[model samples]
Target: MKVVLAYSGGLDTTVLLTWLQEKYNAEVICYCSNVGQEEELDGLEEKALKHGAVKCYVDDVQDEFAAEYIYPMMQANAIYEGTYLLGTSIARPLIAKRMIDIANAEGAEAICHGATGKGNDQVRFELTAYALKPDIKVIAPWRMPEDFPFEGRMDMVKYLEERGVPTTVSAAKPYSMDRNMLHISFEGGILEDPWNEPDEDMWCMTKPLSQAADEAEYVEISFEKGIPVAVNGEKLGAAALLKKLNALGCEHAVGRIDIVENRFTGMKDRGVYETPGGTILQAAHRALESICMDREVMHLRDSFIPKYAELVYNGFWFAPEREMLQAAIVQSQETVTGDVRVKLYKGGVHVCGRKSPYSLYSPELVSFDEAGGYDQSDATGFIKLNALRLRVLATMKKES
Candidate 1:
C-alpha cells in the first residue's frame, strides 16, 4: 500500500512515520507544508527521508495561506468565541487541501495525519480531505490507540531510542507548540491546567508587557476592499506586511491571549496564542468599516461572524455554508476601503483616526453647536413618533 502523510518533524510524527511503514509495510510519502513556521521547517525533508520515507515533499505555501485563507477570514472579522483569532484553526484546511492534491498525484490509497483523537485537528484534517476527495481513505493513528501503543511522550522517546532514530525534542519539554505565519499557539503539558498561567519564558512571538516600550507608536494601515495593502504608507504583499506588523506588535507586547475554549471534540482546551499582526489587522479593518460600510449591512455581516468563525474553527472551510457566508462577507467589504491610524502601546491597539472616500459620516448634520443642516423643532416630532409605543405601554401599566 501507498500512503501520503502530513509530516512535521516532531516526535509524534517521527514515530508515526516509522510505525506506518512497519505496521502496514506501506511506502510512505512525507509532505511538509511551509506555512511560515520559520525554523520549524529547517531540515524537515532530510529528517523525513532518514525515517524511511520513499520521498519527502516540502512546499512553501505561505503567500497562498495569507492571501487565500487568512485574508478571507479577516474580511469577515471572524473571531471564535469572541477571543481566538483562529490562528491554528485557519491553517488546517490549506494543509489538508495540499495533502489531497499530493494523494491524487501519487496515486496513494490513503492519507494520514498525526492529529490526536482528543483534539479538534483530527476533525479538521479529515473533513477537508473527505470534502475534497469523498472516497479518500484517512488514516488517523491516534484514534486507534490499541494498534499504536504509546502511553505518552516518554513512550515515544523510548521507542525512538530503541530503533536508534534520532530526535531533537527532549522528553522534558514542557509544552507543545504550533506555529505559522498568522500566530503561534502553545498548548498541552503545563497548559493543560486552566488555572495555571503560562510562564513568561514560553512566549516566543511577542514581548512581555513589562518589557514593552513606554512610548506609544502610531501606525497607519491602508485597506482596499477589506484587505490590508500598506503599513505606514509602505506597500507590501500580504505575507510581508504581516511580518512587518508582527515585529511592530511584538515590540509593543500586543496580541497575547490565554483562554480556555470549548473544542469541537467535547472538551475544554487551554491555549495561549500570540497573534501580533492579526490583532492589529482586525482592529484596523473594523475601524475602516465604520467609515465605509452602511449601518444595516454592517450589522447583518456582524451577525454571521459567529457562524463563519465556527465553520473555520470546526474545519468546515470547504463546506458550502461557509462559502455562502463568505459570499455575503465579501459583498459587505465592497466599500471597506480606507486607512486607519492606530496607536500601539503596552498590550493595546487603539484606533485613533479613520478616513475613507466612501464615508457616510456627515459632519455638518451632526454638529450640535451649529445645527448645521437642521431645525431643533424637527427632533421633537421625530422623538414623539419613536416614543409612541413606549408611551402606550407606560399608560397601560399606569391604568393597571
Candidate 2:
C-alpha cells in the first residue's frame, strides 16, 4: 500500500509518519507546501526522510498563495466574525490542493493529514480534498481512537523518541503556532483558556507595544483594482509587497488580536494572532474603496461581507456559492484603484489620507458653502417624500 501525508516536521506529523509505515505496512510519501513559513522549512525534507518516509516533496507556493488566495480575500474585505482575518483558514485549501496533486502524481490511494479531530483544519483539508477529487480517500489518524490512542503532545513525543525518530520539539512548550507570510497564529496549551493573556514571548511577527517606536510612522500603500501593487511608491509583487508591509507593521507593534472565536466544530477556541501585513492591507484597501466605490455598490458589497467571510471561514473555497460571491466581489473591485496614506502607532492603523482617480466623490457636489450642484430647496420635497410613511404612523398613533 502507498500513502501521501501532509508532513510538517512537527511532533504530531513526525510520529504519524512512522506510525503509518508500521501499522498499514505502507510506503509513505511526505509533502510540505511552503506558503511562507520562513525559517520553519529549514531541513524539513531531511527531517521527513530520517523519520521513515520513502520520499519528501517541499513545494514553494508562497506566490500562488498571495496572488490567488490572499489577494481575492482582500478584494472582498473578508473578515470572519468581525475580528479574525482568516489567515490560517485561507491557507488550508491551497495546501490541500497541492497535496491532492501530489497524491495523484504518485498514484497513492489515500492522503493523510495531522489535523486533530477537534479542530477546524480537519474539515478544511477533507472538504478541499473531496471537492477537488471526490474519489480520493482521506486518512485522519487523530480521529481513530483504537489505532492511535495517544492522549496528548507528550505521548506523541514519547512515541517518536521510542521509535528513534529525531525531533527538536520540546514537550514543555506552552503553546502551538502556525506561521506564514501573511500572519502567525498561536493556539492550544495556555491559549485554550479565554481569560489567560498570551505570553509576550509567544509573539514572533510583531514587537511588543512597550518596545515599539514612540513616534507614529506613516506609510502610503498603492492599490490597483483592489490589489496592493506598491508600498511607498516602490512597486513589488503580491508576496513581496506583503512581506514589506509585514516588516513595517511589525516594527510599530501593529496587528495583534486576541479573541475567543467559535469553531466550526461547535467549540469556542481562543487564539492569539499577529497579522501585521494583513492588517495594513485591510485598512488601506477599505480606505481606497471609500473614495473609489459608488455608495450603493459599496453598501451592496458590504451586505455580503458576513456571508463571504463565513464561506471562507467554513472551508468553502471551491463551493459554487463562494465562487459566485467571489465573481461579484471581483467586479466590485473594478474601480478600487488608488493610494491610501496611513499612520501606524501603538498597534493601531489610522487612515490619514486617500485619493483615487476613479473616485465617485465630487467636491463640487458636496461643498455646503458653494451650494455645489445640489439645490437646498430640492431637499425640502425629498425630505417630505421620505417622511410620508413616518408621518402616517404618527397620525395613526394620535388617532388611537
Candidate 3:
C-alpha cells in the first residue's frame, strides 16, 4: 500500500517512517508543512530520503497560515479555556488540510500522522481529513490495539538509534514540544506533575519575567478591519508583521503562561505556552475594538469568544458552525479600523492608548463642562425608569 505521512522530522515521525515499511510493507511519501516553526529544513529532504521515503515534499505555508488561519482566529479573539491562544490547536487543521492535498496529488491510498491516540491532535488531524475527504483511510499506529512495536519514547529512540538514524530527543530530557509561527508549547515528561514548575532553560521564545528588559518599550500597531496592517507606521505582509511583533515581544519577555486545562479526551493536561506576538496582537486588537466597535455589537460578539475558542480547540475548524461564527466575526470587524499604542514591560503587555476614525467615545458629550447636549437632568429620569423594577421588589420585601 502507498501512504502519505504528515512528517515533522520529529522522534515519533522519524521512527514511524521505517516502522510503516517494516510492518505494513507500505510505500511512504513524507510531507512536512512549513508554518514557520523556525526549524532548519535545509537537509530535511535528504533526511527523509535516507530514511526510505519514496518522495518528500516540504511546502511553506507561513504567509497563508498567518493570513487565513491565524488572522481569522485573532479577529474572533479566540482563546481556549480562557487562557490558551490555541497555537497548536489552530495550526493542526491547516496542516491536515495540506496533507490531504498531498494525498490527493500523489494518489496515495492512505494518510498517516504522528499524533498519539491520547492527544487532541489525533482528533484534529482525522477530523479535518474526514471532513475534507470522507472516504480517505487514516493510519494511526499509536491508536492500534495491538502489534505496534513502540511502547514509549525510549523505545522509539532506541529503534532509530539502532538503525543509525539521528534523533533530537533523548532519555536524559524527554519532553514534548510543538511550534509554529504564533507560539511554542511544552508539555509531557517532567511537566506531568502539576506542582513542578517548568525549568527556565526549556523556554524557547521569551526570557524569564525577572530577567526581562528593565525599561518599558512602546509600540504602535495599526489595524484595518480588525487585521493588524502595520507596525510603527511601517506596512508589512501578514507573516512579516507577525514576525516583527514576535521579535519585539521576545525582547520584552512577553507572553508566557502555564495552566492545567481540560482536554476534549476527558483528561486534564498541563501546558506551558509562549505566544509573544499573539499576546501583543490580542491586547492591541481589543484596545482598538474598545474605540471602534459599537457597545452592543461588541458585547454580542464577545459572547461568541468562548464558543469559538472551544470549537477551534476541539478540531471543528472545518465544521459548519465554526464557519457560521467566522461569518459573524468577519461582519463585526467591518468598522474595526484603528491604531493602538501598547507598552511592553517585564513580561506584561498593556494597551496604553487607542484611536480610530470611527471612535464612538464622544469626549464632548462625556465632559463635566456641560458641553455637547447638556443632558444632566435627562439622566435622573433615565435612572428612575431603570430603577422602577428594583423599587417594586424592595416595596414587596418591606411589606412582607
Candidate 4:
C-alpha cells in the first residue's frame, strides 16, 4: 500500500510517518504545504525519510493561500458569529485541495492527515478530501485503538524515542498549536477549561497588551477593487503586503480572539487565534466598501456575509451555496477601490479616514453649514408619513 500524508513537522505526523509505513507496509510520501508556519522546514525531507517516507514534497503555497483563499473571505467581510474571520477554517480547504493534487500526481491510493476525530479539523480535512476525490481513503490513527493518542505528547515522545526517531517536543509544555500565514491557533492542553486565563508566554504573533505602544500608530493602506495593494504608499504583492501588515498590527496588539465556539461536528471547542494582518485588512476593506459600494449592493452582500462566513467555517468551501456566495462577493468587490488610513492603538484598528474616487459620500449635500442639498425641514413630512402607523395605534388606544 502507498499512502500520502499531510505531514507537519510536529509530534503527530513525526510519529505517524513511521507508524503508517510499518503497520500497512505502506510506501509513505509526505507532503508539507508551506502556509507561513515560519518554522524551519529545513531538514523536514530528511526527517520524513528517516521516519520511513519514500519521498517528501515541500511546496511553497503561501501566495495561493493568501490570494485564492484569504482574499475571498476578506472581500465578503466574512466573520463567523461576528468575531472569527474564519482564518484557520478558510485555509484548510486550500491545503487539502493541494494534498489531493499531490496525491494524484504521486499516484498514491490513500491520503492521511493528523487531525483528530474530536475536532473540527477532522471534518474540514476529510470533507474537502471527499469533495475533490470521492473515493479518497482517509487514515485517521486517532480513532484506531485504545492505545492511540500515544497517551499525549510525552507518550508520543517516548514512543518516538523507543522507535529511534528524534523529536523536539518535551513534556514541559502544556499546549498544542497550529500556525499558518492567516493566523496562529492554540487549543487543548491547559485551555480545556473555559475559565483558565491563557499564559502570556503562549502567544507568538502579538505583543502583550501592556507592552503595546502608548501612542497610536497610523497606517495608510491602498485598495484596488477590495484587495490590499500597498501599505503606507509602498506597493507589495499579496503575501508580502500581508506579512508587513502582520508585523505592524502585531506591534499594536491587534487581532487576538478567545472564543468557545460550537464546532460543525456537533461539539463545543475553545479556539484562541491571533490574526493581526487579517484584522487590519478586514477593517480597511470594510471602510473602503462604505464609500465605494452602492448602498443596495452593500446591503445585499452584508446580508450574506454571516452565512458565507458560516459556510466557510463549517467546511463547505466546495458547496454550491458557498461557491454561489463567493461569486456574488467577488462581484461586490468590483467597485471597492480606494484608500483608508487606520490608527492602531493597543489592540484597536480604528478607521481614522477613508477616501475613494467612487465615494458616495456627498459632503455638499450633508453639510449643516449655509449651502446644502439636504433640507432639515423636509424630514418633518418624511417623519409624518413614517408615523401614520403609530398615529393609528395611538387613536385606537385612546378610543379603547
Candidate 5:
C-alpha cells in the first residue's frame, strides 16, 4: 500500500511517519505545505527522507494561501465566537486540498494526518479530504481504538528518543503550536487549564503590552474591491502586503487573544492566538466599507457575518452554503475601494481616517452650520408619518 502523510516535522507527525510504515507495511510519502510557518521548515524534507518516507515534497503555497483562502474570509469580516479571528480554522481546508492533490499525483491510496481525535482539526482535515476525493482512504492513529502506542507528548518523545530520532519537543514545554501566514495558535499543556495564563516567553509573534513601543504608529492601507493592495502607499502582491502589515502590527503589539471556545465536537477548548496582519486588515477593511458601501447593502452583509464566520470555523469552507454566502459578500465589495489610516498602539487597532472615491458621505448635508438642502421643516412631516403606528397603538390602549 502507498500512503501520503501531511508531514509538519513536529513530534506527532515525526512519530507518525515511522508508525504508518511499520503498522500498515505501507510506503509512506511525506508532504509538507509551506504556508509561512517560517524557520519551522528548515531541514524538513531531509528529516522526512532520513526517517521512513519513500519520498518527500515541500511545496510553497504561501502566495496562493494568502490570495485565495485568507482574502476571501476577510471579505466577510469573519470572526468566530465573536472574538477569535478564525486564524487556525481558515488554513485547514487549503492544506487538506493540497494534500489530496499530492496524493493523486503520487498515486497514493491513502492520506494521513496528525490531528488528534479530541480537536477540531481532525474534522477539518477529513471533511476536506472526503469532499475533494470521497473514496480516498484516511488514517488517523489517534482516533484508532488502542492501536496507537503513544499516549501524550511525553510518550511520543520517549518513543522517538529510543529510536535515536531528535525532536524539538521536551517534557518541560509540551504545548502544541500551529502557524501559518495568517496567525499562530497555541494550545494544550498548561493552556488546557482555562485559569492558567500563557507564559510570556511562549509568544512567538507579538510583544507584550508593557514591552511594546512607547510611541503610536500610523499606517495607511489601500484597498481595491475590499482586498488590500498596498501598505503605506506602496503596491504589493497579496502575500507581500500581508507580510508588510504583520511587521507593522508586531512593532506595535497589535493582535493577541486568549479564549475558551466551543469546539465543533461539543467540547470547549482553550486557545491562544497571535494575528498581527489579520487584525490590521479587519479594522482597515471595515473603515473603507464605511464610506464606499451603501447603508442597506452593508447592513445586509453584516447580518451574515456570524453565519459566515460560523461556517468557516466549523470547517465548511468548501460547502455550498459557504460559497453562496461568499458570492453575496464578494458582490457587495464592488465599490469597496479606498484608503484607510489606522493607529496602532499597545495592542489596539483604531481607524483614524478613511477616504474613498465612491463615498456617500455628504459633508454639506451633515453640517451643523447650514442645511445642505432647504428642508428644515420637512422633518416634522417625516417624523409624524413614521410615528403613525405608535400613535394608533397608544390610542387603542387608551380606549380599552
Candidate 6:
C-alpha cells in the first residue's frame, strides 16, 4: 500500500512515519503545511527522508490561512467558549484538505495523521478527510484496539531511541506546542494541571508582563468591512500587516491566555495560547463595530457566535453552516469601516480613541452644554408615555 501522512517532523509524527511503513509495507509520502510557524521548516524534508518517506511536499499556506480561515473567524468574532480564538482549531481543516489533495496527486491509497484518540484534532482531521473524500481510507493508529502497545509518552520516546530516530523532546519538559501566525498553543506534559501557572520561561513569542516596559504603547488600527486593512496609516498586504502587528503586540506582552477548556471529546484540556496581534485586532475591531453595526441585527448575530465558535473549534471549517453563518456575519460588517486607537501596557488593552465616516456619535446632541435640540419640555410627555406600564404595575401592587 502507498500512504500520505500529515508529518510535522515532531516526535509523534517521526515515530508514526516509520511505524506506518513497517506495519503496512507501504510507501509513505509526507505533507507539511506552513500556517505561519516561524521556526525553520527547511530541514523537515530531510528529516522525513531520513525516516523513510518516499517524497515530501511542503506548502507555505500562511496567506491562505489568514485570508480564508483566520479573517472569516475574526469577522464573526468566533471566540470558542467565550475565550479561545480557535487558533489551533481553525488551522486543522486546511492542513487536512491539502493532505487529501496530495494523497490524490500521489495516488496514495490511504492518509494518516498523528493525532491521538484523546484529542480534538483526530476528529477534525478525520471528519474533513471523510467529508472531502468519502472513499478515502483513514489510518488512525492511536485508536486501534489491537495488541500493538505504546501507552505513554515515555514509551514512545524509548521506542524512537531503539529505532535510532532523532527526537527533540524528552520526559523532563514534555509540553507539545503548535504554532501558526495567529498564535502558539501549549499543551500536554506539565500543563495537565489546570491550577498550575505556566512558567514564564515557556512563552516563546510574547514578552512577560513584568518584563514589558512600564509605559503604555498606543497603536491605531484601521478596518474596512471588518477586515484589518492598515496599521498606523501604512498599507500592507494581509500577511505583512498581521506580522507587523504581531511584532508590536508581542513586545508589549499583549496576549497571553491560560485556560482549561472542555475538549470536543468530552474531557477538559488545558491550553495556553499567546495571540499578540489577534488580541489587539479583536479588541480594536470590537470598538469599531460598536458604532458601525446595527443594534438588533448585531444582537441576533451575536447569538450564533458560540455555535460558530464551536464549529471552528471542533474542526468543521468547510461545513455548510459555518459558511452560512459567515455570510450573515460578513453582511453585518457592511458598515464596519473605522479606525480605533488602543493603548497596550503590561497585559491590558485600553481603547483610547475611535472614529469613522459613519459614526453615530454626534458631539452637538451629546454635549452637556449644547442644548441643541431645545427639547426639555418634550421629555416630560416622553417620560410619562414610557412610564405608563410601570405606573399600572405599581397601582396594581398598591391595591393588592
**Cα lDDT listed for each candidate:** 0.93, 0.91, 0.91, 0.88, 0.90, 0.88
lDDT of 5 at 156: 83
Query: Candidate 3 residues 158-273, lDDT tens each?
Result: 88889888878845565678899999999999999989999978888888777789999999999999999999999999999999999999989999999999999989999999
**Which residue runs does candidate 2 get wrong by more than 4 Å?**
none
lDDT of 2 by residue, 1-400 (tens): 7899998887778888899999999899999988898866778898888778989999998889999999999899999999999999999999999989988899988899988889999999999999999999899998998999899777887888887776777546688788888999999888888889888777899999988879999999999999999999999998999999999999999999999899999999999999999999999999999998988889999999999998888899989999999999999999999999999998999999999999888888988778776779998999999999999999999999
**Which of candidates 2 and 4 is the stronger one according to lDDT?**
2
lDDT of 4 at 94: 84
Candidate 5 to truth, TM: 0.95
- Model 3 steric clash pairs: none
- Give candidate 6's TM-score: 0.92
- Cα lDDT tens digits, model 4, 25-131, are 89999999888989889988988887789999998989888888898789999998888888789879988898899889988889988887788888888889999
TM-score of 4: 0.94
Flag the better candidate by lDDT, 5 or 6.
5
Which candidate ranks first by lDDT, i.e. highest?
A: 1
What are the models' TM-scores?
0.97, 0.97, 0.96, 0.94, 0.95, 0.92
| Tens digits of per-residue lDDT for model 6, 214-273 | 888989999999999999999777878888888888889988899999999999999999
Question: What does the lDDT read for residue 335 in candidate 2?
Answer: 94
TM-score of 1: 0.97
Candidate 4 wrong stretches, greater than 4 Å: 146-149, 375-381
List, residue by residue over 1-400, the lDDT tens digit for candidate 1.
8999999888888998999998899999999998988866777788898889998999999889999999999999999999999999999999999999999999998999998889999999999999999999999988898898888888898998999998877546688898998999999888899889989888888999989989999999999999999999999998899999999999999999999999999999999999999999999999999878999999999999999999999999999999999998999999888899999999999999999999988798788778787899998999999999999999999999
Considering TM-score, which of the candidate structures 1 and 4 is the better prediction for this target?
1
What is the alpha-carbon lDDT for the whole of candidate 4? 0.88
**Top model number, TM-score:** 2
Give candidate 6's error at residue 151 in angstroms: 2.1
